[model samples]
Target: MRSNIPWLRTIEQFEDEAIASTAVRLAPMGRIDTDTLLSLHLGMTDQSVSTIASRADAIAELAALGSFDHAKLSKGAWRMFKDRIEFLGCVLPVGWLVPERRRLAPGQMASAGENARVKNTWLLSGLICDVETGETLLDRCPACLNLLAWRNLPNIWSCQVCKLDLRSVTPRQSPPEAVAAVRELARYLLKRDIRLPAPLGDLPSPDVLKFSAWLSYFRWLPEDLGLAISPKNVPAGFLLLKRWPTCFDEIVLKRMKASTAEDLAKGDVISRIKAAGTLSSSVARLPSAAAQAIVKSRLETLFGFLDGSSEGFQDVMVPISELVNSRF
Candidate 1:
């Protein structure tokens, strides 16, 4: 059935967030979480919604039912949204990346790079500034330092707790190169076929790029080489190496291997058992052994990139192989 709500139009780059925000406004209590929003939009019970596997399924159901008009989305934009949701997970966890607050008039739609805040996506969570506007995404209320929670507020641009107009706060400065790196990553994620710069474009597939990006977050990798331990600096560091492919050389590989070796050396039988439990808990989504093997192979390919060797090269694989075998 077509949606009876007239203001339920999708915002271009902000489609998911817009839908989420609409769900919150429609809630009788003025606040609703992800599951409740899914149930409400899909006309399902909370229990039934819980059974749904992924956000892509919910979105597809919405599209098929004409809850969201297909004509409103540019063909390319709709395809990218569907592909990203199907391939990656949902938009990265809510509130992980600070968001820019923008006012949306009823039935209004806005595109990316407008003088408004950009929403987070699974691939773009580490962004600090809007690539187009160069505006620093706000993490908290400047007036009260309260963490921003979009769903909890009535007006997205106003801090519900402090009543501060977030837009009035001055934008913080970020490095231009850092902003460019994020823009590149976002573009790559959205349009995998888009020609990219050097080493990123050389990669075989978008999945390989994602696998390498995921490896950058593995806890055992050295802080300097991978993402910073500091939460705030992570976005700046997320694809810093990708922007400079030469940085992934033998020396960097040696450093990561040393770090992995040190971690393995610290573990005991009890620690190994604990690691096994941790792996089991974390990889529940990848339940099959074949799925785990695919991850292993992808990770090996990433190591190969670092050491300038073909996939599954023995010397580089030793450290990661030992770690994975020990944990599993």
Candidate 2:
């Protein structure tokens, strides 16, 4: 047994090395689409078919679990071939996520660098609209009521100084009016029992957009949840909500005996990958009734927590912590 020890050590070390290399490759790419990440794990680059990405996730789960205990029985005979798993399993993906998209991300600019304001401004879109008329509202600036930035003061359409409805003096833009309409909708939702985010788009950071767009459909909740969500992260919130109860399920973090883990191994890792595939960002292109329901549920739960009057959120900004990890 002692003589065979080196063999097991080498195999375990190789697996760790493989996964680490892949993590390094993935870490720098910023936000990577989960589908691409899984495809790389499965050892294909051409994207020859549209197989669900979770198959690869299953394989990766198998790989992650397999790493914990290297095969003592197979080590001596398959030492060399074992390296293939690490290379193919992990290294391949590292290469795949590294700047290989139709549109490359621009490098970050420091202060006084490239025009940061323009890039950020263009990065966002105004999606405000009136619920009753379904008309796109204008940018009703809260400061001067001249259609500028989004604000959270009472009486959304009122001019900050004069306390007069700006629309009475001058026509409000579609975006601002749309936001106001959404807030009113939020108020109505709280009056009832439904939960949702409101004001269309009032959040500061772009990350908030994902939740706003997701919860926008269920505006019967509270406006405090989604208004002013930043534009950049709207997509991620969508992605997370799409993968609920399993992607971040508390059970995913539970501890089990080694034997139980092994018992689950038959379907454990593979099932995870498949589950992940169901929500992989790539799923956005495909339509499924079941998928839509799951996504909708997640959006409901997330905004439900945010919209609850007890949360005491006064402004339109969503806290990064609650947006990401609120178990409720």
Candidate 3:
């Protein structure tokens, strides 16, 4: 359905602080009705009344289905409203209609490197998952199983480690498994919140909250995939390395293989571990206090390849784009 909601970046920037202030601006003296609320808060008008009502009706239906509370319709609706609008906006420009567009919106008026970061954020948000395992895409050096930093590669697809030109390297013989998931995600994003398909198995179609949480973790891609997969209250240090098929060199692998939690605890490394409440703030989202600490200590020791590198997140997203294109 056609939507008039604003873009993802626009809604994301409309802070809660601004909302209250904007509400006050709309009603200087007293409480306002829904019509006034729409006009003042969202810059709506008579011409757009139908559009707003349709969206509200959809949210109301979802609330009826036990998806969320809509009785406190104004505030709850705004949050839900922003998410659906932003997602649908992304769908047109970045997801389904990408082929028809000539170029992505430029990063002009943004500070240095901001454009690339924005683009990568959108790209990462489009990740196609293994519906069963939640395993997303990753690009690796087939020879060494090393994660290829595609941003640093030459025009030719050369492996940084074994120096093999992978352009002619045949893809795996396995069937393309992620195609259905990718389409399902795109359809859910383009349309609105609905029950996910049978293949997804009762996972709620992607919503603002779910997408936002994933986006938070997604900003830190391949390097942080370790965190994305870690479960609540679990130690992530050694477990993260053991859980995922990550790429590590012989020296680093040997160091990781030989190290114990005690060794990690004694290691001298600048830790970024901080309290994040239930937001999965532990390093690599390690839930165990000791695990978080252990992973914090060894972060520099183990994943030193990404240490102090600005290119870690942006450069690592190339594989996702490639994976998406392969399906088409």
User: Model 2: residues >4 Å from true position, as ranges?
Assistant: 1-127, 130-134, 140-184, 187-190, 193-268, 274-328
Sort the predicted structures by TM-score, highest score first: 1, 3, 2
lDDT of 2 by residue, 88-120 (tens): 122111111111111101121122132211111
Alpha carbon deviation, residue 26, candidate 2 (Å)? 58
Candidate 3 backbone collisions, by pair: 227-284
In model 1, state the lDDT of residue 145.
Answer: 78
lDDT for each residue of candidate 1 in 1-328, tens digit (9 for 90 to 100): 2242433333233343433343333333324444454556555454322122224454455444334453331121212232232223323323332222332211111232222332323213445566555555655676897765553454445675888766556555457866776676556545554563453444444333443344344333444444533323444434543444333333234543434423432434444333323333223323234434544344334333333433323222223323454652
Cα deviation at 209, candidate 3, in Å, is 7.2
Candidate 1 structure lDDT = 0.40
Per-residue lDDT of 1-328 in model 3, one digit per residue for the tens?
2233331221111211112222222221224433454454444544222233235654443233222234432232222232232322342212311211111112111221211111221222344332223333234556787754322222113454677655435432213444444444444444455442222223323322232233334334445555443111111121222222232222234433445433433432232121111122323333234433333333434443235531332233112323554653
TM-score winner, 1 or 3: 1
TM-scores, each model vs. reference: 0.46, 0.19, 0.24
List of clashing residue pairs for candidate 1 = none
Candidate number of the best lDDT: 1
Best-to-worst ranking by lDDT: 1, 3, 2
